[model samples]
Target: MHSYAAVLRTPHALSTFGAALLGRLSYGTVSLSLALSAKNASGSLAVAGTALALFGATSVVLSPVRAALVDRYGPRRALVPMAVVYAALLTVFALVTRDHPGAGTSAVTLGALAVCAGACTPPLGPTMRTLWSQLMPDRRMLQRAYSLDGVAEELLLVAGPLLVGVLVAYAEPAAGVAVSAALVLVGTVALALSPVPFPVRRGSGRRGSARRERTTRTRPRGLMQPVLAAAGVGLCLGGLDLLAIAFTERQHQPGAVAWVLAALSAGSAVGGLTYGAVSWRSAARPRLALICAALGVALAAAGLAPNVYALGAAAAVAGLFVAPALTTAYLIADEAAAPDARTQAGAWVNTALNAGISGGTALVGVLVGTLPLFLCFVLVAVPALVCAAVTLHGENHRKRH
Candidate 1:
């Protein structure tokens, strides 16, 4: 009996680990796939930027709707249809983008395809985390699980681009897109059907979120506080990402771009581990917000560095805050979410972050082609500083509350 029990547990553990890995891989591939597509087809940085920005913007608008469906219909049910549509869109993107002539019409078509693809794939992190929170429920386990989730996110961000770069450099850019779609198909399907963990809320009136929604309705100004703060911070982070992109391209060092971004992500993985390991007894919001603000200022300074080496160093320091800020913001949202709006809160976080990134990219792309690289950094830094100031304000508000 004991041996059989141990054998059963091993498969479950492996399943969970596999699901986590696949989810992160799927999440991380989007950027690499887009970058490869734009670079290969259009051969223009501006076109690449357009693809990335459009994808992010579409995801921002689309993720909330997907989350709502996931909440109501269950992730498994939602994932089945979404995965099929998403894969089909990627197929079209890869095929059409391969031989595309660099023209205004091609750019528009590519951008439209990216948006459709982005909107279709539900935001994986929120859905995965929500499912984890249900499956693991013990506060300690949940904390560790979330940290691992963040680390997986960072890992995917690092690995996905590097892998796609290799595939593109060795075979062809179209190959990278094909591989990404295949992985998304395989991994997303695995995630949906994996029986080790189940949905957090099955839309049951007597059992789940309906009751909680009613109670949360009476709690102050509701979702306004956390949602606004999250969006503001997201805008700052997005600006930083764009600055990095512009800096790399302006330096005439396209190869270095992925490496620098990977370094920053690696730093965040370390930070997520650190945050998850620590056991704080009370709400760590004020302290976390302060830390995140300082991190933002530090990152902005990295942008001002004269050379790539110095910039990478600065980015590393800034990267330290990425996971912490993300984890903290998500934590705040979880605590403050209305019952009916809990899923929406997660979607808002996704949208806010993507919106911030898209906004920053669009704004920076205009100046990047015309200005000095360092100047672009300075421009990007301004928004980061603004974000830090907003976070500081949040800290003060929290103290009063």
Candidate 2:
């Protein structure tokens, strides 16, 4: 608690944290909002799914570029305008879909608009982690901050959909999208104005040569290992979501799907907070491997669960390892990246995660009807365990080198 307090006590930390979190909350809404809007407009689930997939694909493609821009320019310069543009695009999408319901051209335009929004979407998650590193340079406090971040992400994942659902139910799907845009615009603007000192391009100075040497020294190697590992984590998460839904539906408790999924997120949030509070003596990489392995085992158990309640319990246990694994993955990526390229490095993790989710969701969709739910869970575990083994191998190879 004291460690977490230390991070909070940093000047402007609360404001920046709040803004970043609010900005990220927008992420949770966008997919659902787009899907709902497209479905309403086109009267087709297929169109909705395609729009959502295009959005995710665009985001995965553009994340690293956005992060690199943040690295080159200050966050304010890079993020503020992008946020405004992204919000405007969201508004445009909502209005276009609403006004031209069932128009094929509107769907195409919405897809194009989604692509633009993806390009302009502020990299809030990576940027916040970077800000935490800068504000709380102490390793323990930084770990806590990262854990808090992971927990917040889990919360957003749970809440974002709920919020969108409520809005769409009470008003319309376009309203949910508009609110999502508003959150992104307002939150990002506040964060941009916060008094955090972000990194900028190198300037000509007498100490330039020393700075250059330091940059070279801190340059990261073997970055692909961490990126791939993060993706595997995402794959497991995405697969779990689909499997949980299927499990609940099989039990004739489709309504309980939300609660079961919430159990997973709730468990993850608690676990993240606990993991952050502890002081660990082990190196991050090996710990990452162990956590990944644990996640696979727990998820495999979830597959074998005989009842919905049992599956939920197993999922909670699986959730316990999620934040720790992700936090460690982020730390590893930071350590492996060049100081100058840290933002982009973190973005790579984000990209991999998005890609993994997209892949996992698509894969599970194809197999949902054909395969048993238990078998699906086991299949999902394979990527996670593979990632763990690969991480162990990479670490060993590095030692040998």
Candidate 3:
């Protein structure tokens, strides 16, 4: 296949991709929806914030565990039950918010529901990537598929909040929650039915995801390269979000923060697609380290921008490496794992990225208020440079031994 079109033309590609995006879209919606629903029902920002935090805590922390289920059982068996139960909990949560007024709902009850709902959050993104690994054995084609997947995901996250904003204008925030439930339920069912991940018979002359799952002796140590790289990117992004807002405020153009941040996402989208379109001869592991280093350099330079326009441009430049870094990391992680553990491997990267994002946000929040923005940006970039140096140096050290 010479183009992305050819990659999409592969069997079961469109159906599975569509289903995965639909299910993944729920994640984009649920955050805002849950936050709004909690606030409206509880009428206490503290309660609402606590509920959302608890939800995120369980969802992000338990991601790999859920992915492990997909690996242990099968996507069909593991995903269906998780989606159904997750959807049910979301529906019940919506209803609880709808029925209860301020003080009518106990804080404990809402917090528990949020935690439970998050715990069952299906691992759609990781599963879809695993399906991609199964569908495209050609390294080049798989890269295209991942780039397509990553860009679409970026768009969905942007679109999800806009959708919730529109939805809440017509109805309660709970309506958004209900819609999220429906989306996941329908999407998960379709994905589980897609033609992928069948266990291949021995001597079938084709590799299968399930064929590797039945084995126990698989080295997951190679996972560190991508995981660390992903964490570095996530930390950079998380800190950048806050830094952008601070910059805009200082410039007296607080409204520009939206487009400034949009610039970041735009850069990532273009970078991801362009990365997929290119055919690289280098291995993904080394490519990931280099991209992370490039991202760090871009971000470090961003702090030195003289004005808002320059800052936005620097951010866009930094964004260029963002998607490529993550896409390459995914490729490396996928290659590191046995077929059965592919989902788990991908989930670990996902978890690290999300955790890094959360940590970066918190860490930057503290730093931005006290330190100069320039210093903050430099601090955030350190993670990426260190992670990159560590990975590359380890590889070099191993070569000499």
Best by lDDT: 3
Query: Which of the two candidates, 1 or 3, achieves a greater TM-score against the reference?
Result: 3
Q: Could you tell me every candidate's TM-score relative to the true structure?
A: 0.77, 0.92, 0.94
CA RMSD of all predictions: 5.4, 2.8, 3.4
| Candidate 3 segments whose C-alpha is farther than 4 A from its true place | 99-104, 198-218
Candidate 1 residues lying further than 4 Å off, grouped into runs, are: 1-14, 34-53, 97-112, 196-233, 241-260, 300-308, 338-342, 365-401
lDDT by residue (171-274, candidate 1, tens digit) is 76766777777877777777777675554444455655667566447433444444544555556566667677767776777677666776777778887777
lDDT of each: 0.67, 0.83, 0.88
- Cα error, residue 37 of model 1, in Å, equals 4.2
Two-way lDDT contest, 2 vs 3, winner = 3
lDDT score, residue 245, model 3? Answer: 95
Error of 1 at 304 (Å): 6.3
Model with the higher lDDT, candidate 1 or 2: 2
Which wins on TM-score, candidate 2 or candidate 3?
A: 3
RMSD of 1: 5.4
lDDT of 3 by residue, 70-162 (tens): 887787888899999999999999999995557557789889999999999999999999999888999999999999999999999999999
Instruction: Show the lowest summed lDDT stretch of 10 residues, model 2.
Output: 213-222
Steric clashes per prediction? 0, 0, 0
Name the top TM-score candidate. Answer: 3
